[model samples]
Target chain A: MSTAPTTEKGRRTRARIVDAAAELFYERGVSATGLGDVIAASGTGKGQLYHFFTDKGDLVSAVIRHQVEGTLAPQRELGLHRLADLQEWARQAVLQHERSPVMRCPLGSLVVELSNRNADAASALEAGFAQWRELMSGWIAQLQRRGEARTDLPADDLADSILAAYQGGLVLARSRGDLRPLETALAMAIEGIGSRRAPAGRHRAHG
Target chain B: MSTAPTTEKGRRTRARIVDAAAELFYERGVSATGLGDVIAASGTGKGQLYHFFTDKGDLVSAVIRHQVEGTLAPQRELGLHRLADLQEWARQAVLQHERSPVMRCPLGSLVVELSNRNADAASALEAGFAQWRELMSGWIAQLQRRGEARTDLPADDLADSILAAYQGGLVLARSRGDLRPLETALAMAIEGIGSRRAPAGRHRAHG
Candidate 1:
């Protein structure tokens, strides 16, 4: 709800508030995490928190948007964009899970908690998912155009399937404190892209 | 925590507390809901509540089990079993989404909130997912043996994929308040079962 800060100090303060809010929301859930807690954690006064956010609803939307970017930044740079094999993405997902075995998909966890609870927050969550799914679907489309993926379904459908599997896998993974479900689901999803039929003779053994 | 109810009246009181707690948990969230609210909503005293549940943690596991059965009962009876076409299941799922457009998956919503917060509750959620997956996998295995489904991938993989897609679809669907994501994801999943080869002439000619 607040306008972008013109000063560097103001921007830093705003970012600090969002980060504190996100952590509290993730750890204790939205309704239980109050502005007082956020103020305390961020070490910002009520005047500054209010200057940045119109209210709790406004802050929750900002938090959801913040979490979506945090969750996707690495995948865009480190995992998906430069990888030659989609399976590499799956492998990295497992490794990340091994590193942090208990956190739910940040955006996804927000969706379940806020989807039906707040209208403004729900729309923000929807926008976050759409942005992430668009990035994933763009990759699926590129693979399809190159004939490395299934043609029987629309690229959007294929992309949606993979995203769904991933989100669901995270739910099970976090619930079980195990990464196998995420690993298996992602592996099967990549297989669904038809990577196995990549003109078998074209890429000969290097050795 | 508390001992199992030994009398019919005690069992009913315990069930009432669980049902009321589940409603509050689903409406708000586990952390946001209080035992006092549950006791008030269920018309039970604090002593009665404690007679059945030792604490919030114990009640949460009960709530998850309760939610799981609630989600599966209709599917087990009117959906998924003895269906000549897997598409039927997808269609019904879409219809159910239409009927209940605003609510999150009961078990799944609990998962995003409690998975990492409590180990005992997380195990209960995991057991719930496994029970649902097991039922679906049993059906998939039977279909494979009858030559009505894909034989290339293991039935457990197929089942897990379907479950993951379904869970993910619910997340997306709830986030957007649109049924298309769920519909598309499920349609693609049923197709993954490789159902096109169901006896060329036996079930054909009707079209």
Candidate 2:
């Protein structure tokens, strides 16, 4: 029902709508947020909204994609090559949670609501999570090659485990309105990585 | 607006309404489900529904309590005195996910939808998580006294970390429609608990 933007102005218009929608969805939830809310929040006309999105489902998918990009952009930038980077990643998450009013993962929050109900949004989220796992796995693989991590466990599994610790930690943190659960969970997960490890003789020598 | 049930029949009627609401909330989310949906799902009259619940918010709090009891019932029954018991806990979770139509923790699924928006529901959920964590920590403390777990780590942190792995792993598993992440994350978390432990020499000799 909608077409991709052809011009810079069109792209900007669509971006505005999606950004506004993403905020509303994160705060109120996709089920509770209406198109009228998005249009009002974005300061865009109904015509502009319809021109860019076919329906609420379409808009939800776009928001999911946007959230995926936002989540991955910073993670992709991180080297994730050393234990210190992994430690810093956990530290930053706890710090961010402390500063924020509500502790919800922009993407993780969407999964429970959309995964079973919305196919398009679920696929977008699945792809995003896969990319996240692959990036972390790549970093772990590199560390394994340098004898900096445990070679006994597959990098893919290790990455997934770390990801699980983070996701589960955030849920507990949100429920309790505290950071201790997230902090302890991430710390233990990072510590688990160093368990039964190959000595990082070569990697340690450089630093 | 609703009063406590003074009779057995009143208790059953209230429980029926709460059960119906919990299912609809889990499947469709709290925002999308209405009181009418509960009435239809429960085959109860409006008068009965209103008699049991002051409003949807009251019903949501009741559902949270129901879910907490459901989540903790099985956990309390487990002795959780050894590593094998921990492994079994993880295995049962993965197996349950495989068997169920949707992958979600009964209580966890509610946290994101209600944690920020509803104060009463938030308090109920926070109390449930705290109770759950305390139960897990109690088990870990018992293990520590028996030299079955790492004493270097606090029982509370270990419990929280394991909980995080279970929760985060479930989110990833639900997103991926696969069990590997949940399985790996939990396995690694349990493995971490036994890391650098005091030897269970006495228990081992008895075995």
Mind giving the per-residue lDDT tens digits that candidate 2 earns over B18-67? 89999999888898899999999988889999997889898999899899
Colliding pairs, model 2: A168-B168
Q: Provide all candidates' interface root-mean-square deviations.
A: 8.6, 7.1
Docking class of 1: acceptable
Candidate 2 segments whose C-alpha is farther than 4 A from its true place: A195-207, B195-207
Per-candidate TM vs. native?
A: 0.85, 0.93
Candidate 2 C-alpha error for residue B98, in Å? 1.7
Using Cα atoms, each model's DockQ against the true complex is 0.34, 0.50
The per-candidate TM-score of the B chain, in the order shown, comes to 0.86, 0.91
DockQ of 2: 0.50
Off by over 4 Å in 1: A75-84, A115-117, A195-207, B76-85, B195-207
Error in Å for residue B139 of model 1: 1.4
Considering just the first chain, candidate 1 attains a TM-score of: 0.86
